[model samples]
Target: MSLPLPRDLARALAFFLAPLLLAPLALAQQSGAASPPPPAQGATKPLPVFEIPQSGVEFQTGDTWGQNGQTFRLYGIQSCIRGTTFTNPAGAKLDCGEASIAYLAALIRDTKPRCTAVAQTASPPLIYTVCAAHVGANTLDLGTVMVTQGFAFAATDANGKPVNLQYAVAEGEAQKAKRGLWIARDLPHPTAILNKALRDAERAQ
Candidate 1:
């Protein structure tokens, strides 16, 4: 009932995820850690950390964005790939990837989360981060919210090993609850599509 991931994406995931696999930050974690200790008395004050606003920010997928001329994705979240389709209740096909993008856009617009750089990939430059947003006086992980609500999924390698076990847990719960994208019984998982593409590519080798 499950499919594998492609090698390229798997490797990309590793760079963004290896650190998380070893140590996951506690819930409500923010970019405060990036802030240096206050300057000594009378010393020049350090500049406050800058924040990026979600307004007009472009989304590459449900979990990725184009930032600073590079790719920025949530550390352990994978959105559906673009161009995939699923049928709606009205018997019309809808773009699953676009649906994911829309959901993420809504979440960003409503939550205004703040993210800190957690990892990066060489060459192409993919910045990975963990973001938290305030909801009802409680700060929550953005990736957790997306996966738990079924708008995104836990990032995994080609063999299906998850980056963060907790994200896998969230995804499982969402699936069980049939939330968001899970509501479509015939939903086409992005990883499955990638796996098939990989297999086909390998066969042609």
Candidate 2:
């Protein structure tokens, strides 16, 4: 049997179909609202920097020499003696080695501040004793800063065992030297310093 369609029913169906066709537009608007915007490209934060004392030593990025603003290392210059070692605070031993103070000092004086450096050592009671000026520029980097200081040690025999020997280390250059420093004991020579200390100790006893 054939049935007749109602006019109201046809109008309601058209209205519902019109909204269904526009559902994609509604979904697009909802998606835009739900997502966050992308961050700006090439944006970056700056690095932080801190200041240190002007007189303080500035070490290289990977340097192990400096601690609490002071830096130090072992230096070697030509010496006349043999078979001696100085123990560091860390319990490591350095053979005093040997070098000429006159030669080492001259080298330091002639060398350019940032271009050249003589290796040497400086510890308390004998600070910066290896170099002439007690300060030098780093050869590896011109911008890096360094200072040398002299120290005196009571000279002993080939072993670290102390004797009545007093020695003065002349200032030399930047960097650590295997020869230690050219040392003067009592007079301008290494022998005098060792002899003086031994004589003095004997007299005291």
Candidate 3:
């Protein structure tokens, strides 16, 4: 006949078996196979890098269209303009044309200081350079970034020359931070607007 085990030996056996029961659970935590963290509020992620080939672009100026507002002299391919997120579907370009006055308004609002003067010309079409991609990084103020397909127009006469409308990217120099003119460089593309604005500002001094 076998003798009964001591109480201390039984307690030790139970302790050793405890981790065995929870091993899979512990492994999961250590391997970091858990759910992803949620996104923070108002985060503006950097957009992808997209460039409009200089060739596919076309230029036209003058209030031909019965539209009113700021113009974005485009240098890239003409993208179809959907309605603003407020009035129409956010990204639907069904009835919209190639120009976006709302975008220019927003750009002017945010970049008033640097853009002391924003006017249209009747000559060479202005070049609107779109970053290779959309703005990424949702960490910025949603009100500070304008998320839309990009476009630009002629800032001078039909001579195809660079007019004052030619802008540069002015990173961190904006005093108001309008969402339209604001290019979230936090994304991975070269922002010609910000770059041009910065250059213009530097030259002004």
Candidate 4:
């Protein structure tokens, strides 16, 4: 019954109504009534959550563990290797490596230990981490404890310098107390022992 709108008039009306048509959608978004779209395919994945075992942990060495098919090495500490023997101040033969592992295991017993990755090595696929073990009201830094207890040495860089000064201090304290490896009259540094072992292996090869 109404006459057809003029073409120019019809176009003008549509232009004016465009924003009005979209107003509800805008309001819905602003009011949190609409959800965001899912991420696009091939998006980067989120990082995995860190987890620790409920039961106490056991170490393959004072500073390393193999879990879930991955090798983890403790940061800022190094321990003697199995078959590495030294003499105690009491003139007794001591298997330093075994003793280190035993000491670490004892610390982990009945304690919930958790570790966060701090570094990684590619040559041997090792993850270096700082781990904390809860004991009563105190939280123990496992790596620092190892050095302080003289079961392990402060780790060193390729230039044979201490990796961390805090660990160095811990080692110094252990030395002063004449604990574990430090009890030896002629204490052999772990780095020197490791280097010598490497050289010997190369010569044998």
Best by lDDT: 1
The ten-residue window of minimal lDDT in model 1 covers 22-31
Superposition error at 85 for model 4 (Å): 0.6
lDDT of 3 by residue, 11-103 (tens): 222222232333333334335857322212342332112322323222221111111222223221112222211223343322222234444
Q: What TM-score, over all chains together, does every model reach?
A: 0.74, 0.20, 0.20, 0.66
Model 3 segments beyond 4 Å from truth? 1-92, 95-99, 109-149, 164-205
- Angstrom error of the Cα, residue 49, model 1: value is 6.7
lDDT of 4 at 11: 29
For this target, which candidate reaches the highest TM-score against the unseen true structure? Answer: 1
Better of 2 and 4 by TM-score: 4
lDDT of 2: 0.27
Q: After superposition, how far is residue 109 of candidate 3 from its true place, in Å?
A: 4.1
lDDT of 2 by residue, 1-205 (tens): 3333234222222221222232333234335755322212332322111222223443211111232443322122113222344454455554332222223233334442222111111211111112222244533211111212222222223333222111222223321332223222221323343444445545666
Query: For each candidate, how many residue pairs have backbone atoms clashing (under 3 Å)?
Result: 0, 39, 56, 0
Worst 10 residues of 3 by lDDT: 113-122
Candidate 4 Cα outliers beyond 4 Å, as residue runs: 1-58, 89-91, 186-188, 197-205
- Please write out the lDDT profile of model 4 over residues 151-171, one tens digit for every residue: 888765545566666788999
lDDT of candidates 1 onward, in order? 0.68, 0.27, 0.27, 0.61
Compared to the true structure, candidate 4 yields what TM-score? 0.66
On residues 87-169, what C-alpha lDDT tens digit does candidate 1 reach at each position? Answer: 77777888887888899888878888887665444534455667787788999998999999998888765677776778999
